[model samples]
Target: MSTTPTPAQEPAAQEPTTQERLAWMGRNSKKLILALVAMVIAAIVVTFSFSLFSSSSANPGNMVGTGTMAIENSKEGIAILTVDDMLPGDAATGTVEVTNVGDAAGDFQLASSDLVDTPATPPLSSVLNLVITDGATEVYNGPLASAGTIDLGTWQPDAKHTFTFTVTFAETAGNEYQDSQTTVDFTWDATQSTS
Candidate 1:
């Protein structure tokens, strides 16, 4: 009669059951587990890449040392030559041994210093001629006061060299040098050799 007997009223909708809600959550949880597994796999790969490219080294035997430079003479501080009663035309010769007394090779040199005159008037050193020789090589040949630095070449550790010093009273010296006397010191210098 009325319309077509209004369609049977549909049953009221019901709230989701606990089991159905749990089933929905379980489906989403599976997707979440898969994403977490992917993240863990990515982290492992990054760690291995860093380990493969890393490098390291060590040197336990490395060492260092230092060397020394020094020299000595057989006479040390003693005089190489001395005379008291020297006169005109008189000559004296003395020999000394020089050595390199260090752990390294060095360049040796000889020079005169600390000259003293007794009378200080006649200047005895001017009239005294000095000649120094090392084997066959003449190291210096000049007046005692005019001798310059003389190079003795390179010497190795523990090496020894003989030197001869000869002083001659010039025959041309006159009576003014009768009471005049002279004294001097011999100096040895050493420097480390480059070669």
Candidate 2:
């Protein structure tokens, strides 16, 4: 008898048709594109989060901080008390002016603190020498508003507001420190002596 190959003895598998191959590729390509889009969105979210978390100490949207002290000279503006000298039982008159040296709207608290007693003398309460005056009349007395607020509104190039806080020395406990330039050696800066 002659030996013949049976149909069951054919090759393991047949090659796919062009249409079938295209369908397979299309299915996988959709999944790949979807994954890439998700990854991109996630990266964008992380970048924004990091930027928000790492920022400097600054006010936002045209808000300025009141950090300038009138004691020092400033071109952007200044607050100064004109006085012959800062001493106890002595009167030094000056006005607190809010001048906008820069073209920025700013706010500040302008006030003097209570007289701090130092040197622990024979039991003496140091009095803050001050009297707030509105024009010629004395509106308020005692330390000239320990804490006063000044709203500059809009600086508008060059402009300022002047408010007077005239004060007189009440009573102080310490030594005389009189000098053109001298450091008041006590709990607060006061007259040690006229040098």
Candidate 3:
């Protein structure tokens, strides 16, 4: 007889009415609006960051590699010095010009490889002496096979430096060096001066 629930003792489980839901939303509206505003501001900042890095312009003044360094022989390009039937005490000479055609000054250095011989039985390079001169200054004077690097000093922009190289067969060479042919190559390097 007491099983029926009274209105005051009814269960509290009930869906929210439209008015209660609207009131709850209204209370939190400021927080929702602030979240949306923050998202929008972050998007704007990211867009501007991308734009700042995407656009590019070229300025010729800021370009590098506009400078040049080159070497030329008296023959206009690479030169060859041939000594046919070389005998003891015989010598040959050649010349080349190093120029800085760029707008920047540079320091120059020279290097030579050991003289290679066709008949390797007797290394003719061991019996050869080399002399290199820049105008009146002797930059290198040593054995052709053992010569290392030589510094030619600094060169100004648009300036040219002339070099003379002489190769001589040692006077002390004997008959064993006969018909032994040798060849040597020279390299010139340039680095831009900082000072």
Which numbered prediction scores highest in lDDT against the true structure?
1
| TM-scores for the candidates | 0.75, 0.31, 0.62
Instruction: Give lDDT tens digits, candidate 1, residues 48-101.
Output: 988998998988988898888877788998999988788889999999998898
lDDT of 2: 0.45
lDDT of 2 at 152: 20
1 or 3, greater by TM-score: 1
Worst 10 residues of 2 by lDDT: 182-191
- TM-score, model 3 to reference: 0.62
- Candidate 2 or 3, higher lDDT? 3
The C-alpha local distance difference test score for the whole of candidate 3 amounts to 0.80
How close is each model in CA RMSD to the real structure?
5.7, 16.1, 9.9
Candidate 1, poorest ten consecutive residues by summed lDDT: 1-10
Report every candidate's CA lDDT: 0.90, 0.45, 0.80
Candidate 3, which segments miss by more than 4 Å at Cα?
1-77
